[model samples]
Target: MTFKIALIGCGGMGRRHAHGYIELRKYFDTVEMAAVCDVHHDVAGTVAAEIGEATGSTPDIYTDFDEMLGDADLDGIAIVTSTPMHHRFAIKAMEAGLHVITEKPMGLTLKACRQMREVAKKTGMVLAVAENYRRDPMNRLTRALIEAGAIGTPYFALDIGVGSSDGAVMHSTVWRAKKEQAGGAPLDAGVHNADMLIYLLGGVDSVFAEIAINESQRTLRPMNEVAPVLAEMYNHRREDGYDTGDIVEQTAVDTAFAVIRFKSGAIGQLIMTDTSHGQSLGVSTVSGSSGTMYRPRSRSGESPRIVRGDGTEIMGDALLDLVPGFELDDTLSTLWNGARHISSYDMDFRDIDSKILAYEYLDMVQAAESGRQPEVGPQEGMDALALAYALMESGVSKTPVTVEDVAEGRVSEFQDEVDAEMGI
Candidate 1:
């Protein structure tokens, strides 16, 4: 059966989603993009036309999401709206009896995630959060290895990256600088690492985090308790709103590092930064009893497979970078099959088709709706937020907080590694 998809929001990320849906048409039976929605008529209208040109079928466009929900008869709405509006759009879609695939963090709080889950139950629809990193092909291989005990007993791991957006020049995504909307680097970027980390090691058992923001706050305005504007952005100025050089204040942290304890008795480290003075994007290294695998900005592992225990060298290919999709083709295909598509893999952009994983997550929701087990459902999102919130609480109170303690403790930690790294 072809899934009739309605895309909400057609900004940069939304456009990418449009392309993914079109690509899936070849693999699946049908993936008809029935409609598109965005408050900015120009953005939505333009994207709809672009997609029509690409897919040979024009999708209905909407200026308001509610109206779209009322008339579009969509299978599900892929929400790519701002942070503040997520709760509104998501609940609204679920209430309309359509399944929902929403952008991440679920909401600002664990309570919000629960509210979404309840809505899903009451409305009898599905709600899937998009955390694309967990679906990368090589990452899938890593998960398989860990599950197969190739990594022995999982213990400690580190996440690292350095790229154009992942490294310096991060401010390019200006919305991220504002707290009311973007949710900082942790929510914007680090959360990807956080979610992937949990999937591999299991849900967090405990977390410790600390956050800090030190810069001119003069460039922003609160957006009606939702998402405000980054007015202090040099080009975007406000009149008499903020004194020059004043710091914009939100619950967001400019830099954060966190440590998570997982169900598998393994601990994980996550760090994200918007300010890279002399540094590069980091790498992720998972160290286990058997061996360790290191992945860099656009690559992972060494050329020829190195020797392991019993002095036996595993001589494989002396490969290039091993990111996701295209770059890691030789490995993922060798593991899966030759069914890999050569198009999306050539960009060297790490996990180019994290969308597949995102869709698989959506598939998990469909399963939950069917009364089957959901791989990563609302409970998982709530669990992640709970751990992050707990870590923040621990940092502020100068104590350790267990994962079971998040619902009771809601102060919400904004940074990690800062408590120990900064010793505050």
Candidate 2:
């Protein structure tokens, strides 16, 4: 009973998803890679070959999405396309009688998000978003601790991220730097930050943000002098440390700071930047009435810890000891050093971004088979996007924008541009 699935987009993220599918197919016994499609035939063929090598199934490759959809006997389509094409692909695939799971930020606009959600409802198909960050073990642990009152009556937290993308190959692209395509770094990274807020805290009521293009088209002296420093900051190392091109101009708001007012009366201060040097983007701290919980900057390396207001440490050993004989493959497992670790602390968690995608893929496929919705549905993705757009609107208007405004279509210019561009 292997569920046949096709993957769309053959970029960096696409490859990661393919790799996950190959790995999960061995474990799940419920899904199979059927086809790989990209705008470029060679890229699709290349990914198809990789899938073949891993899954022993060489998927058919296609450059045109419609031709692939029409030809393949796929039960679902996993879309990892760029931001602009997400809505287009998801709508068409759902309309064509296929379940859809798309990469995050759901769609560029609230209108587009609603459209996709409506189509899924009408078609009675599974519509899910591959927001791996929400499935990250540390995040789940943090949420569990908060709910357990380790962080009693959560009030405030910091969502801070600072790192230079200058030498990162993914950030050097045009889609990441342009507003029309991806909404730049704000939407690209901010959506994950926003989702964490909602997942742990609650829905955002409003957001007041200040977005800046600080490092716009700046020239560096030379790579030879700063290669070592650049390598440390970006986490990507090479002999020369200069593969992302000499001259880089970022058109998006690379630096953004926002104040999110949660519907539950909690507050979150979000700080994200691609211009900062020698820092990690994943560091987050949540504070409440009684104690605080902190998630480390690196997911694969560190586990989250909680500290009481009186300075009592909730040790990892004690937490792990609380949940004995817990199955690592159970829903209550968290990623610890690339392995599943069970603890009362995490409750149950997941990891490895692609593995998260595989989990979501399996969920969508199972849901399509059983007539249930995925655990992480498109509405959650839309809510996250609402906060993202509110940040942008607040930044542009120099004031706070209510999530309701963005959710109800009061916020329209940027989304309008996206819809017009995509003919949505």
Candidate 1, 31: how far from true, in Å? 2.4
TM-score of 1: 0.75
lDDT digits (tens) for residues 103-154 of candidate 1? 7776555555666778987886777776666555445555555565554677
User: TM-score for all predictions?
Assistant: 0.75, 0.86
How accurate locally, in lDDT, is each candidate?
Answer: 0.57, 0.72
- The total of clashing pairs for model 2 equals 3
Among the numbered candidates, top TM-score falls to 2
lDDT of 2 by residue, 1-424 (tens): 8788888987766777886787576566778888988887777777888888877879998889999888999889998877888888899999999999898878867888888999999999899888877665556655666776766788898888777755332233445665667646678978888888888888889889898887666443333333342322223212133333455455566777899888899899988777766665655888888878886542343466778877887756454443343234443232223356533222212225556666677767878888988867887988888888787778888888899898879876556766677776
User: Candidate 1: which stretches are off by over 4 Å?
Assistant: 161-171, 216-251, 296-351, 354-375, 407-424
